[model samples]
Target: RVGEGVRGKVAVREGNGGRVLMMLATWPTEVSGDVVQSVDTLLAGVRPLPEPSVAVRATPRAPEPEPGDPR
Candidate 1:
């Protein structure tokens, strides 16, 4: 899932042998032709994950709000 304030595009598709292929692209600022180029560059260097897969998990911790008298 995309986070708030983030700018990007993502796509997911099923690959051969029931594997899932995910593509995520993020631009630091805004989406444009340059962002497409960035995505291409990132994809070019990607390698498939090794077999006997390992799962990575994390629990998101909420960011602390700035000091204020009101919530």
Candidate 2:
């Protein structure tokens, strides 16, 4: 009963601290189940990863002044 020319009902109700909207309709049996399951987890999950490791890379110490190289 929710297609073209279909008439819907509405009302105002007091919620915990505010007004809440409620919509009622007869949906396809299959669709009703999927909608009730919730969409909070519709997409994939995720988690944090440790920061990448880093090291201070210095020039190869200038070949270390060859042992007998003249000054």
Candidate 3:
């Protein structure tokens, strides 16, 4: 798990009887995208975090009227 300023590794087992070894590392926010991409590319062959799949969800919110315009 990623925290404020530390990084480490953990062993994880999958429900399908597969084992995945991972190295967890945290990077400072100041790090550039290129560096991150490089690291991702290097680790592409390794099995990634298996338990939790990364997801992005958008929540619907009330629409706001445009500035200087009548609703």
- Expressed as tens digits, the lDDT of each residue in 1-71 for candidate 3 is 36675433343433333654555545665677776676666555455444443343355577998899787
Better of 2 and 3 by lDDT: 3
Candidate 1 per-residue C-alpha lDDT over 15-43 given as tens digits, one digit per residue, 9 for 90 to 100: 55678788877665556777778777776
Candidates' C-alpha lDDT:
0.65, 0.40, 0.54
Model 1, which residues run further than 4 Å from truth?
Answer: 1-5, 30-32, 37-71
> Of models 1 and 3, which has the larger lDDT?
1
Q: How many clashes in each structure?
A: 0, 0, 0
Tell me how candidate 3 scores on lDDT.
0.54
RMSD of each: 13.4, 16.8, 14.6
lDDT, candidate 3, at 20: 47
**Candidate 3 backbone clash number:** 0
lDDT of 1 at 10: 62
Relative to the unseen true structure, what is the Cα RMSD of model 3?
14.6
The numbered model that scores best in lDDT is 1
CA error at residue 66 for candidate 1, angstroms:
68
Q: lDDT of candidate 1 vs native?
A: 0.65
Give the total clashing residue pairs for model 2. Answer: 0
- Taking all chains together, each candidate's TM-score versus the true structure is 0.37, 0.22, 0.37
